[model samples]
Target: MKNYVAFTGLIGAVGCFLLGPSICHATENGGTVWPLGVQTVLPAILPALGETSLYSYTAYYKADSFKDNRGDSAIPGFKLENFVQAVRIVHTWDVTFDNGVTLSSGVIGSANKIKVDAFGSSDTDSGFQELYLTPLYVGYSPSENLHLQTGFGAFVPLGNYDGSKLANSPTGNASYTQEFDLTWFPHPNWEVSVAPTFTINAKNDNTDYRSGNVFNIDYLLGYRLQSNPKVQLGLVGYYTKQVTDDHFDHGDVEDGNRLRKFAIGPQVFYAFDQTSGVALKWMKETSVRNGPKGDSLWLEFAFPL
Candidate 1:
C-alpha cells in the first residue's frame, strides 16, 4: 500500500509537468458541463460489525436537464440532459491490531450518461450522447479516521453526431485517477476530511474534449445529531483544476484552455438500524465561463445481505 501511494504521487507530478501551465487555466473557472453525476453519494453502507463483514450494496439513479441561453434560438430547448445509474457492492475485511489500528479495503462500479440536444433540432443530428461504465476502483481505510484510495478506469462513448461529438461526450475520454483522502474527528459528532485527487487521460478526441492532467481538492464536513444516531447531515464541496495542456485526441483544436468547477450541497443519512438505511442528496453547478451547467437530485436505499 505504501509503495502504491508513492508511485501514484510520482506519476501525478510527472503528468503535471508534461501538461504545462496553460492547460491549468482552460476549464478551471467553468462548471462541469459534463454531468459526472453524483460520484460521492450513495456509497456502500458500512456495516456495524466492528470486525470483518460484507457491507451492503446500494443502487442509485438520477436525471437532470439544463436549458441553453446561448441566444441563437428563439426558444432554446433543453440543451443538456443526463441520466445516471449505478450499483456498488462493498466488503470490508477489517483487522484490528493491539495498537488500535484498523485496515479495510473495498470496490465500486457505476454506469453514467450525458446527452446534449441540438440548438433547435429534434433529430439525432442535433447533438451527442454517451453512456458508459465509469467506476471500477478499490479503496482502503487505514483507520476509521483516515482513508486513501486509487483506481484505474475507462470511459467509452455510446453515440456521436458531429465530428466534434467525440470531444464533447462525457464518455469519450478514458483515464486513470489516483485519489487520497484524510478524515479526522475532533469531537464525537463532527468529522472532516481533506482529499486531493489527480486524473490522467489516456486518450483525448481533441474538439471540445481536452484530457491531460487535472487536480481536485475536496472537503467533507459532517455532523451527527446529538439526539439520534439514526440521523446525520453533511456538507461537501470541492474545487478542481486542469493542470496540464488539455490534450485532444484529434489534431485541429487548441490545447491551452483551462477548466475549473466548484460545488457544495447537503446530504442526509438515516439509519433504520444496524442493517438498513436511506440517503438523500442534492447539488448544483453554475457556469463560470463557457461551460455546461446543471443540478442533480439523488435518493438511495441500502441494506445488508
Candidate 2:
C-alpha cells in the first residue's frame, strides 16, 4: 500500500503534463456524465488481480440545442436550432494496491460536429477537441456491498472554441471539477450508484467571459436478469444546475445569468466476454431553464486490459 501510494503522486504529475496546459476551457461541447447510463459507467469496480488495468472506451451522443428566442413567434428565424454530434474516446488506467484500493487516471479527447439550421439554411461547425483529464482517482470499499470513489476532473481548453456563438459550454471558460461517487449492492442482483459533482470556473482570458459555477448529479439503478454477468437492465438519470451567475466582459452582462436542467432514461448492457462490454442509454430533458432543452442518447463500448 505504501509503495502504491508513492507511485500515485509520481504518476499524477506526469499525467498532468501529458494532458497539456491546465487553464484552457473547452467545456460541454457535447454534454456531461457520458450521457447518463448507470449500467455502463467505466471502472465499475476496482480490479484486485493486477498492478494496473487499462480501460479504453468510446461514447457517441446527439442533442438538440437552442438559445432564447428574440422575435416573432411565427418566424423560425426567431430562434436558432442546432443538432450536435460528439464522438469521444477516453483512456483510463487504474493501479491497484496491496490493500485492494485503486488509483485511476485518464485523458479524454473528442471530435465534435454541429449542424445549425436557421432561416431555411444551415451552417456547420466541426473540430477535434481536447475534452477532459482526470488527474487522479481513489477507490475504496468499506463493505463487501458498498463502493466509494473520489476524484477531480480538470476542464481544459482543448476543444474548438469561439466566444461569438449564442451558447456553447465547450467554447466557454476553464473550470475545475470535483466528484464524489458511491455505489451499493443491496442484493445479489440489485445495484445503485450516484455521483455528485461541483465545478468552479475562471474568466476566459480571450473574451473575459466567465460561465457560472455548476452542480450536477449522475445516478444509476440496475438489476441483473437471471444470474448472468452477460446482461443487465437499468435506469439512469442526471441533473445539472448552474449555482452561480454567468458574466461577460461586456457591461450588459455584469449582473450575471444561470441555467439548469434534469433528465432520465433507460439503460441496457451486455458483456461479450470478460474482455469487452457494451451499453446503450437515452435521456430526455424533462425540464429546462436558461439552458438547451433537448434529448440525448449514448452508445458506450468498453474494453478491459
- Taking all chains together, each candidate's TM-score versus the true structure is 0.62, 0.73
lDDT of 1 by residue, 107-216 (tens): 33333344444334321121223322324334445565554444443333444423333113234344565555555666767766556666665543433455546777
Among residues 3 or more apart in sequence or in different chains, the pairs in candidate 2 whose N, CA or C atoms overlap within 3 Å are 24-156, 24-157, 25-157, 27-170, 130-158
Best by lDDT: 2
Off by over 4 Å in 2: 1-99, 118-121, 165-170, 227-229
lDDT of 1 at 25: 27
Error of 1 at 113 (Å): 5.2
Badly placed stretches (over 4 Å) of model 1 are: 1-78, 93-109, 112-114, 122-170, 205-210, 249-252, 274-276
Q: What clash count goes with each model?
A: 15, 5
Q: On a 0 to 1 TM-score scale, where does candidate 2 land against the true structure?
A: 0.73
Best by TM-score: 2
